[model samples]
Target: MRLTRPFRRLGPAERRIWDAYPTGAWVDLRTGDKDTDDPVNGPAWGPDRTVRAEVIAALLLGAREPEPGRTAGLRLAGARVTGELNLSDAVLTGKLHLLNCHLSEVVSLTDATTSGVRFRGCEMERIRAARCTVNGLLELDGSTVRNGVRLDNAHVTGQFRLSRARLHAPGERFRASESWLEDARRPFTAAEMKERGLGQDQWAVWAGGLTVDGGAFLRDLRVTGGLRLIGAKFHGGIYLQRSVITATGSHAVQADFMEAGAVEFSAGFTAKGTIRMRSARVNGVLSFSEATLEAPGRTLHLSHAQVEELIWLPTSVKGGVNLGYSRIGVLFDGPASYPDEVRLNGLTYEALRGRWTVAERLSWVCRDSDGYRPQPYEQLAAWFRRIGHEPDARRVLLAKQRRRRGTLRPTGRFWGRLLDLVVGYGYRPWLAGLWVVVLLAAGTAVFAAVPPAQIDPDEVRSFQPFVYTLDLLVPVSVFEQRGAWEPVDWTQWLAWTLVASGWILATALIAGAARVLRPSAGS
Candidate 1:
């Protein structure tokens, strides 16, 4: 049960708002320059511009009921609100707009249900609206909150706008009573603090599990601490264009497991710490075009997420980016936009939307800092093959083999190098045929110049040097002249070389043919 407020006890500003509430009129209490007289810390305003928070709360809660058949609302501009506006668990049918007002204490709207709520250009310490429900737009556009805004588990039926808002979060402090040292019977050190999860609670927007029916417009917003949206759901997408977020934790924008239609972190967006979106799903495009991310370690973490289209054209990145295990429908990227270190293991995409050459695209695959990963190469090759660029697909597969060769032992590497020189790991099968022709011609020329003595002088027909040479070079004796002929001196050594070369060439040809026949054999 709440206390009633009589009209007789209302101050000049409160009485004016009470009378105008029945008509839903705009009560502008601004006198001169509002900037010169900052309502948060300036000299006390006269009665005309000062309203007690209790009177406004009473009107909003129906303790001081308006006339029947009239739509009652509270709309004030440039007023100084004294005391805390505690509207916890209240149901308000009217729309509330407090434009350019200065709220002195914490505005607690915990578990309240309202038609709409707008605090545009208002200055407040903080807002505690945990579990609140808004039917229409819940906007804090252009407002400055010194502490932060907490809307954890809240639901909004309409758009949630916070464009151009400034949020300076109150950083985490040491709670000595809850220290792990007392529990563990040890001294508290930095290592202990890290192991025990003793850290600061500096979050600009703690909206975990928040559900928005419409879009979340956070464009041009500035946050001094982390923006956490863990498990939040946005139907109409999230726009973070031109926003600046800086924080001291592991992630500046921690949005793990969140789901949205689309997410635009583009158009001059800057984050001073990691922007982690682990396991998040977006049904539409997730863009980072022309954005900047600067962190000490991993800059953009998109592991295990699923997105329709991923537009990755960041202006700059100070740290690494991880896209491991993510599935994308289409990926649009630029050659020079990638960071020095990247993680692309288990990443899959249906189509690559770019005009870059195969070499440039392969460079993107080479940026993986965790040595060689075969999946990225295979995925690139598959995409190229789908688009009828068969040669480019072979090039990607050839590079994959070359990268894999680096990790082999000396004996394996020797065999790999021989295969590469002879057949290009079967990606260039024509090289093997060309080598066979060259070696055949060289062998033909060597034996034709110096004739070999006949091993069985009286047994066979005349010694044909070309047929004898062919028999020496072929792994199987198809010509039947090698047994009848014998070579001496340097020609004898050449005959032995031809036999060994024949076996190597035959083995290489068979291996190359097998690989070409089944392209996914070794892969």
Candidate 2:
């Protein structure tokens, strides 16, 4: 076994780790909580449980030669590692397993390739592994990272896990005095931790362009800053069940342009800032069920994405949710799940699953922030038509015309209202028939009371009041009474009024019927 330094210069704890390096045995130096434990109290650790990072790195990088068939690796626990573990650009064949250790400086694995790495229950300042590759699993479950973890453009052949982890943003400083660091009787309180810089609007996990062959499990993860995975590709899906991300004035989780399988952001998930997933592609379901999103600006922006199915039933949303220009195979949502403002323009869904009435669903479309958009109405109407609800589909189209009327000029609006009152924008054809019947009755009564003198007294046809009224009202057919009899004074005026009303009714009826009969004209 090779050594970076002579064995005579090694410390007691370092010598113990070196002796166990060849056999891959664990060098458990943990005694109690005060020995070398805790992330924030690393500065107060004694020399008994301390391990130099260079010594450990050298050993992992072929400093020690194992037996012919024995696997050699570093299995450390409960140690305070001083100095930086810079393994950048190195190809390591051995595995690294650290448990409950506290490393004071940043661990640089930039551009390095490793077999496997596990940091279970460990605490580190940061991990800078940009563009690195991992052949096996990279697990960090139950660990704490004070600054951040940057795995940008990295590729992992196995699973990348961070379940039950706590991560803070970069540039966070420990502001406690040296006297308090050594003489403090207990851990800092929550308020004191805030003063020590717990929250910052930086990237806690910037894994943009990362490609993971297996799943990225982030369940129960707690992050104090943004968790960005923009343009990442995950073949086995990304799970975030019960995760909580708090980053005010910035995006809490930004997975824009990400391609994944069954991304689950459900089950008690909470985020303080926006969760943007613009232009993403998901092979399976993307859910946010039982999640809580609160942001001053847009809470969710899922525009231009394509997903197989979507389950969006968040518990509460403080800011607006935008799903504009997206396409989904199936959608599951509810009225109570929607916020006051939403953007559904150009969003297309094949099937809808909910126990909501047509009115409630229409209300959902009306909540779009862009006022009245015809596409949303058309989309909803098409869904209704697909479900065999022809009347409900017409109702949606009618509402669309009513909303569009408000955007027109005064004369156009007047004409629109006339169409609405007469035919309900072609959706209610019976309204025109009802008006025709009512006007015909009134015209008959008026002509019966005030009969006019006959124009031709020698004509054989009789002056029938009801027949004359019918002749005046009907534009298509003419009765003989209209040619034989003439109306003067009040009767003449009533006849002229009936003829005008008849023309208007016939025109309206033709227009409404054509619109209803032809699907393209109705749309």
Candidate 3:
């Protein structure tokens, strides 16, 4: 095929080629337009108004190459353009890309792909597409999107790389609910790559360092292999509710520094593979309420990360959500914020059956000015009761009371003295009584041995037996007649009898008292 005239526009010859070839075989030509000036415009310019609509349509239907340097816009809807659609540097102000380009084989856009199909550096006001499919990789590194990029249900068989791309407006939503990426390869090598789990020949999403100013949402994306977002920053919240990632691959999502209002990984979804979020900071709550992580050694390492709100792992979840050293602020209240403030009610550790330690260094930065307020003792006691640790809780309460007593009114000097006495000489009372009894008995015995001072022998002899008897019978008479009656002779028997009787009575009284007061072994 040769061009008769200077190929300034698409003609009937090119139109026939487009109509003859399959949709996948239509190769897009580079039009050498800078995308920096206007983000949405494609590189190529279509034919003029003089060309018939039917002819222009035919030219773009499935043609390998459009007329070189055309000045008209191309509209190919459902053309089933096959093979590699090389729109490397084409400029199209209108919607240059269509819904779906039917591909019997693979496709390639070494560095760029767009709804308006721009190449190099071109600017377009708007780019819109509902559903598209590329059999091969879609590479658009260093590209810029202006208003909005919409790719709702696009299917790409190979790896998707949009690293270092800037989205001024809200970026496209890759809601590839039913799309699949089969037999894909990693865009970046293993060493330079910060992400993992790229299958040997499986689909992958590589968007490392891609910045979205107005935020991006991946609502229900189902990636067959790994989805890498190493160092990607999202300004708005990212929701991954009810999404499933299979076990054949390693990582399901690898987004670090994922700062936003909130990030959810709930709704009973299972990640048989690992989910790595090392050093990822979540400004708001990071919820994994009922999600299950099936991988045994898989970890969600957020060490040294800061969370303004809670990092909730409610008791309903099955797998352990390790928050080893991460600092989390207030916890969740309900489905939203409850208690008019962030509470720790929804925060749980049901899955943490084994041993774990909370980081001592990092303190939670609470939003309330009063600072990190720990739960009240009563609340903790109730919680312990519910968990069957009430005794422990009661012990803590008693310990607190003792501490208060020690602090408020300490013991005085008098108490100190009493304590000393009790510890030292308290047992002396019983010993002192025993010694007194022994001394009394010894004095009695000594008196009994010494015969009463012998009354004068002459006086005794003078006293007649009758007089002596009368005197003894009446003690008053003996005192009165001390001069008249002769002094009775001091008899050893009488003295001994009196001393022994007196000692016996005193000993009996002492023994009775001792028996009554002293503690017995059996008692």
Candidate 4:
């Protein structure tokens, strides 16, 4: 298409606008026949037909000249605007709406100030709204931004809706992919997302550090590149329901240190990269009930995060989820079928929401199978005891002990196993007493056949076996039967063996008694 210089001929409306705003260069964009030189051949040309960068900027700011000024407002539809929409550092009070319009270059509002500005169903080269302040909403819904939307530090006073918007343009930060959402009508709560998960082949958007004063709705969005919202904050709830994002290289949704009211990735939400929420603070529930997180390492990197409500992940994670050093209200809120997959090291949860019994709960805590992690078990046991779940608490501690035993050397582990059998780790003390009774009966029978006169120098008769056995076995107590009686050569060996048996039985009994004295473990 051939372009002409600033319009040599202007219609009545075009002349009026050019005369009022004489500082801009209006060009014949030649988008349609409406800007023809002859009015009879096509639609009448006017200020609306002008496709100049400065002209659009002045109109958006309600200025008659290229410099910043105020006017009633501007609402242009099906218009063609040329050059970058550079409104940076300019202040506009009225609503500036550009509907179904096409831009020739990037829309740069970097560090610019404005009120309610919207570009519904418009086609722009790109956008640079970084550090801009929108006193009202700055919407771009149903629009196709070719390059990308850079709202890194932009502040929006009202709601920010990027719902169902098409974002393209691979950026230096992340590559771009087509947005293909799986489901769009589901609720933002992520309730029905169990079994069903997210789907995405590529990732696209990278709007990190975005701050929204009002509610933010990213629901039904589909991105092909990384949606890096690291350190982003919203005063209200952030809905990511039915959105699919991929992390070709970077994280799919890296919202680290983000603070929001209710941040959800519930229904039909799928992510390929790490959904990092490190050090994030959510005032309400941060749910991913039916979402699929698929990063190989650190799939859901939520370390040091504080969520006020339960962090749901029933059919949620695909690769693995890391909650290390995180503080959650209810840590595990789903099925305990495969507990070994979730990492809960250094995690502290107030309540556990699993249908499993006390043993099952203990089993879930040790699911990582990453060897003995004393901190995880200790933290879990402490939490269980705090809520008067004494039995559960004891079970957890027992699990910790067992886990620790498994990692010991062969000799140490064997010794531990011996203790487990003898007294059930001090769990059963009666077995020690039963051993004493059996040993006393055997010793009494053996000594009854031998007479004390032949074994001793003094003239003593046959001894009472029961009395003699009692004196020989009771090492700590004095029964005084062996004082005057002595056994001959071979008989003396039997008596000495009995003395050693007495010492062994006494030690076992004391050990069992000590275990019984302490708190009892759950059955």
Which model is ahead, 2 or 4, in terms of lDDT?
A: 2
Model 4 deviation from native, Cα RMSD in Å: 9.8
- TM-score: model 1 vs. ground truth: 0.92
**CA displacement after TM-score superposition, residue 244 of candidate 2 (Å):** 1.0
| Clash count, candidate 3 | 33
| Candidate 3 structure lDDT | 0.38
Residue by residue across 95-119, what tens digits does model 1's lDDT show? 7999888888899889999999999
Per-candidate TM-score against the hidden true structure: 0.92, 0.90, 0.38, 0.72
Candidate 1 — which residues are off by over 4 angstroms?
1-8, 32-34, 37-44, 172-200, 519-521
Residue 48 error for model 3, in Å? 24
- What C-alpha lDDT values do all the predictions have? 0.84, 0.83, 0.38, 0.66
Put down candidate 2 lDDT per residue, 1-523, tens digits, no spaces. 3445544477778888787887888998777756436645656768878899998898888878775687888999888899999999999988899988899899888999999989988888899999999999998999999889999999999999999999987733343222321312344566755665543325789899999999999999998777888999999999999999876225788899999998998999998878999999999999999999887778899999999999999998888899999999999988898889989999999999978988898888888866888898888888889989999989988888888899899998997888889888778988978987787788777767877778877766656666777788787657766666778786677778878878877777777777667764343
Weakest ten-residue segment in model 4 by summed lDDT: 179-188
How high is the lDDT of residue 261 in model 4? 89
